[model samples]
Target chain A: MKKINLLFVLTLGLIFSLSNATFKTQGYQVGDTAIDFSLKNIDGKMVSLQDFAQAKGFVIIFTCNHCPYAIANEDRIIALNKKYAAKGFPVIAINPNDPVAYPDDSYDNMKKRAQEKGFNFPYLLDDTQDIAKTYGATKTPHVYLLDKNRVVKYIGAIDDSPKDAKKAKTSHLANAIDALLAGKTIAVSTTAAIGCGIKWKK
Target chain B: MKKTFFLALLLGLLAQGAHSQTIQTIKIKDLVSHLQKNDDTLRVVNLWATWCAPCVKELPYFEQAHQHFKNQKVKIILTAIEDELPKVQAFAQKRKLQSTLLFLDEDNANDWIPQIEKNWQGEIPVTLFVKQGKREFHSGDFTAEELMTQIEQRLNVSKE
Candidate 1:
């Protein structure tokens, strides 16, 4: 019985270690201020997070070319950028996935995708993935919204749909952006992001 | 001789194409039918995609657990929701994914995603451990050891 007890204690310790192996991701709250970082855009131009923050607010989307969820929302993102850019709220899209594992999400493909899709905003690459790590971006299409003060206003899914746009019941990203633009508090500050998980380098 | 060799190569290519295994695309209907069989058989289903980095990283763990529990009445399925069928089939073949491979071809995932679990936020690498009516949905990656432990615990506690 003593031997069995020792074995159980050892097993419990092993389980705790295994479960904690994954890096702990940070969650963005409503009042948290977002830090700025420079990253290369699809056109090979250096774009800084502060460049967009000069305006009323910014839409920082953690996205990649490969994920179907990101691909599906391409149009919506473009539309949001075009619609809100004039209002001093432009989208600062970032590709956070490691390029080595996913060649499709590399800088070259990002440029191709941006040009092909006619993205109005700067589609940047988080080359070192530091920006993604800082923001704790875990999904391909995770979103982060900031107000004029550079405080994180929202962090969550683009919408409630991956395939069918008609069936989407919630527009978390949109609602947050609209509320910020209209000078109103966002109703939903955070929601669990859904999409292809970000591939991080070992 | 060159012409004959070229002809042989062409024939080989055609044969290979003909013998290619079809990626069984699972719809909601098929999933329901699969669940109906051996209602007592606990099912641990993982929804993933070939392009998803975390999903690809953690898939071998699930496969290992599936092999470990093969003797038991439990069933494990790994569904890849790649828009391109050929890519998924090629990936499965390359990885030799042993966990009853499935391709979810539905363009509208919201319809079926909720059907599997309402709490699911449409995240890949999400795991569903279900036995009879009891269900535990986890939305993240797990190591081989962690997954095995989870399988053992869930299976033991499964009432039905």
Candidate 2:
């Protein structure tokens, strides 16, 4: 009986270790202080959250040129900047996709798309994919709203309806921003939306 | 007249073959029930979208698995998240997909995503494997060999 008990304990130890081996690190959560990045914008200039000294907060969106979901929210992102840039919370779009895997998301293509779409805000490139990995951005169009101190206020989708703006019942990002501006607690700090996965380099 | 009749018959047969796999639109509740069904079979539910390139790339692997495990108790379900039914139908037809296709019609992803898998960050090409109430969620694309290995492991487990 003692030998059997020992065998069972050994099996349990093996199972626990195997499960831990497969476990992944979830990078950041709401209320975590997000690290600032010095990524290059489309205009060949380095930009960072610290550079926006006048800003009260930021709408740091992890998006790209290739993902259809990102394309769908292009106008909405622009509108967010237009509406909130003067309000001290501007939009900072980041292309976190690997350029090698998706050439459409290359720095040159990003410039072209930004110019063509008349993007009012700075569209930066997460060339090394470090910022995205740190922020735990898994898909295109993932939003991480931060306060002036760079504390992550909200994380996830921009709105309930990601494909269509008219069908959006609740703008999670907008609502969070409004609550932050008013010094009220954000009703929903996180959300999820189906989107194209970020292509990591092989 | 005979030629025309034969042509019509051929077209009918072709249409039947083309539509052998039809896309069904279901709410999250329906999907949850299906997942919770008490059965000994291994269900490979892959959540994908038409616009996602990686999802499209990994679809053939699922189809291959379906073909290989057709006689076994293994079922492959290709579920589309936040996509239009017509587009999914057209894409399935174009690709000649053989696996069962499902259009997850629910739009509130934040609510349903956790229901499917608590850790799924709403990324496309994530696959869920269910067997005898036990479940395993894979959050990224899979190669053919990798998928086959997973299915084989699950099948062996069910036998035991």
Candidate 3:
């Protein structure tokens, strides 16, 4: 049965090809140097991590408008800037979602959201997602706390609670910032919290 | 004509009343216990949420795999954490998801994220394929063809 043999071979070949799925590398781990970028902010001006000359460090947040988790943290992000910007660890937010996939996160909508939220920090757009990729961002509401040297001192969720901000008992970002400000080692270098996966380009 | 119209309307309403999707909220301990040791069956647990776009996008792939590998010993279960019953149920019903669906009640993500996977950062759309107490974890979206391949690979590994 030559025909049967050929059919079997073809099926095997298909299985082999499928089994070889391509694996892409993930983003940076803790203790890694975070990459800097110049992405457009809601103000229509390009913003870079190096632009904040006076800051001792930064609270880089990879967030988007479409994600409910990000929406929940918007006010808290503003608060972080209000409290820390004056003390030098300003919040620098970047949206990494592809607007074509999530039209609500488009530049125009970003401008509107920033104004509506009264964002005290720079809400930049990661149009190419290069900065996000370099920093190893996997989802929205992801946070990376870095020193003035751009060294990522901490990474993960803002706090333990995502549903209700009031229920948050431990402020992870605040603790890390405080440690850096006090010139003490961060108590918790990394932590995980459930978040919306970044909407990557199709 | 009026009687026929009324009769048809009644039947439509009755048919609409019958819904099939089931959403359950269970403790993490129960979930861990459910991952029973099975040498022949491949259990695929997909962690997702209503707010996660990638998880929603990759659902069809799991569904297609379930249908295509009907004769194979494979089970696909979807677990959504953080989404309450109303939201999780609505999304499952709207998508007509055939795979088993669940909602995780344990909130303190810091406590559970590490328990599930030491390396996982609590991101949604994470899939775990388990066979014979061995697990293969994949984070992010997977195409249908790629999923099928991964299934076959896991199956083959377990056999050896």
Q: Using DockQ as the measure, which candidate wins? A: 2
lDDT of 1 by residue, A84-190 (tens): 88888889899988788789998899989988999988998888888887877777788888887778888777776655567678887888888887878888877
Clashes of 1: 0
Worst 10 residues of 2 chain B by lDDT: B13-22
Residue-by-residue lDDT tens digits, candidate 2, B42-114 = 9999998888888889999999999999999989999988788888888998888889888888877889998
What's the distance in Å from true for residue B64, model 3? 3.4
lDDT of 3: 0.84
Q: Can you give the DockQ of every candidate in the order shown?
A: 0.23, 0.53, 0.48
lDDT of 2: 0.88
Q: Pick the candidate with the highest lDDT.
A: 2
How many Å off is the CA of A79 in candidate 3?
0.9
Docking class of 3: acceptable
Candidate-wise lDDT, in order = 0.76, 0.88, 0.84
Off by over 4 Å in 1: A1-17, A22-25, A166-170, B1-44, B49-64, B72-122, B128-160
lDDT of 3 by residue, A19-74 (tens): 43222346777787877889999888999888889989999999999888999999
Q: Estimate each model's TM-score.
A: 0.66, 0.88, 0.83
Clashes in model 1: which pairs? Answer: none
Docking class of 2: medium
